[model samples]
Target: MKVAVIGTGYVGLTTAVSLAMNGHQVIGVDLDEAKIVKLRQGISPIYEPGVEGALNQVLNSGALSFTTKLAEAQDADVFFVCVGTPEAADGTADLRYVYSAVAAIEGMQQAAPKRRIVVIKSTVPVGTGDQVAELLSGCPELTVASNPEFLREGSALADALAPSRIVIGAGDPGTSEVVEELYKAVDAPRVVTTRANAELIKYASNAFLATRISFMNELSRLSAALGTDIVTIANGMGLDSRIGPEFLRAGVGYGGSCFPKDTIALLQLAAQNGISLGILEQVRTVNATQPVWFLEQLQPFVPDCRGKRIAVLGLAFKPDTDDIREAPSLAILQALEEKGAAVYAYDPIAADAVRQKFPNVSYTKTAEEAVQGAHAALLITEWKQCVELPWEQLYESMAQPVLLDGRNAWPAQIVKQAGFHYVGVGKS
Candidate 1:
């Protein structure tokens, strides 16, 4: 399969690289000249584990290429729109990027008529693919299929190479078969359905995962008040086959490119349809306040944050990625700064990104550097460097040995024995 992946963001690059690795000749198209140039030189613009190495392998093997124009990939058998559909001001998914990609593909089809599947791998609302199909209805040779990606940020490359499932949503049986044939090399369960179902599945999956996190977060509040361990409770609940342990960790909250925006867009979509997802509404509420709630735990230990040196560990939303978009650490930083706390933050990769938004907060190279002489330390993201530490050394160096485990990644028993005042989310 000669695949053309439009947009060189996380999804597009990973998709292009993975497809090329699977022995398909792939051309990655992006409007950005600099990104294309970098890709041409086998340099990945994004920092995803194993993607750049795989990209270099494919590029060297002549399995992959890069282009600034969609016209360069005119003869491609499959066109994947991996563009970002960012949340609009009104909370709906801004589909301008998607529409632009589709229009470009439409123009390509007109110039050189051929059988090609315009697959919408970008996350969008229900009926988006059908709308795209209708827009290109004149071209009988072109097929529009919704193939939503389920790539997590930290392990995006791995997820793309071996996905949990492959969903192909096409209006016609012929289109479905063609799309399925494109992914024939990948071994995953297939869900061949309508375009609408496929689109909704992407949004619904994120929404449900957000709901689970929020549910546990809200439960953690109860656990905190009752002096019960949320971790133990989660483990006990996970023992039941019906309630498997995933996204059950009670943390400050989930923040990333997906969950925060997707949940809001789903709510907005539901509102437009006159369907009130009250439970999901509450889920968002819990998430919005979770970081603040976690910060409130600091009050009992340090009565006033004024003139206090607070060390914030991990600035990224999650572990590996440098993406600080919608990261909880931002909210924590804001609150700390507002309360007159001299903040020192450290992330192995994401500190530079956060430094742009928060110049006042002191950024450090190492977690130890951030916590040095600090009154308290907060674990915002559970990066290994941020979680695992020289307990005795850190305890002796801190102005006050107060540990607030927002993610509950720190070993409470060990930290307690080390003579640090450990305060964890729902850990008594």
Candidate 2:
């Protein structure tokens, strides 16, 4: 298959590279000349494990290329619209980028009529694919399909290469078959359905995952009150087949490009449709207040945050990714600063990016530096470097050996034996 992936952001670039690696000739198209130049030189703009290496490998094999214009990939059998649909002020998905990419594909199809599937890999609302299909109805050779991506941020490349499922949603079987042929080599379950169902699958998956995290977080508050361990509770619950553990761990909250935005978008979508998702509404509430609740745990140790040096470990939303979009650390940091705490933060890869948004928060070169002489250290993200450390050294260096495990990642028993007061989400 000759595929053209439009908008080389995380999703687009990962899709392009993965498709090329799967024995397809792919050309990535984006209007950003600078980004295209970098991609042409086999340099990936975003950070994901093994993506750049795989990109260079495919580029060298002549399986992949990058271009600034869609006409360059005019003969492509599939045009994947992998653009971003950021959240609008009204809490709906902003489809400007998706629409722009679809319009460009329409222009290409009109100029040189040929059989092509305009695959919408971008996450949009339910009827987005139908709207796009109508836009290209004049082009008899062009068809639209909804093939939503389920790539996790840290392991996006791996997820793309071997996804859990391949969803192909189109108005007709011919369009779906054409899109299905592109992923025939990939080993995954196939869900051939209507465009609306496919779109809802993406949103529902994220919304449900967010709900799970928030449910556990809300339960952690109760667990904390009863002096019960949320970690143990999660493990016990995970033993049940129906409640298998995933997103059950209580933490400050979930943040990233997906969960926060998608939950809001889904809620807004439900409202527009005259439906009220009460449980999901509470999910967002629990998540929004989780950081503040976690901070309350700090008061028992640090009576006054004024003039205290607080070490904040992990700034990115999660480990192995530098994306801080809607990251809970931002809220935690703002609250800390408001309390007059001199915040010191450290993240192996995300510090530089976070430094831009928070100029006052001191970024350390290493986790050790962030904890040095700090009154309390908060584990916001469970990066290996942030979680696993020389306990003795950190204990000796800190002015007061107090540990707040926001993610319940640290070994509470070991840290307590090391002469430091440890506080986990629902563990003492």
lDDT of 2 by residue, 1-428 (tens): 89999989999999999999998999999999999999999899988999999999999999999999789999899999999999999999999999888888888777888899999999999999999889888988888899999999999999998999999899999999888888888999999999999999999999999999999999999999999989999999999999998889999999999998998999999999999999999999999999999999999899999999999999999998989999999999999999999999999989888899889999998999999999999999999999999999999999999999999999888999999999999773
lDDT of 1 by residue, 1-428 (tens): 89999999989999999999888899999999998999999998887889889989999999999999888898799999999999899999999999999998988899999999999999999989999999999999998999999999999999987899999999899989988887789999999999999999999999999999999999999999999999999999988899899889999999989998899999999999999999999999999999999999999888899999999999899998988889999999999999999999999998888889999999988999999999999999999999999999999999999999999999899999999999999887
Off by over 4 Å in 2: none
Winner by lDDT: 2
Candidate 1, run of 10 with poorest lDDT: 175-184
Compute each candidate's TM-score over C-alphas: 0.99, 0.99
Evaluate model 2: give its lDDT. Answer: 0.94
In model 2, residue pairs whose N, Cα or C atoms come closer than 3 Å (at least 3 residues apart or on different chains), thus clashing, are: none
lDDT of each: 0.93, 0.94
What's model 2's TM-score?
A: 0.99
Q: Which residue pairs show collisions in model 1?
A: none
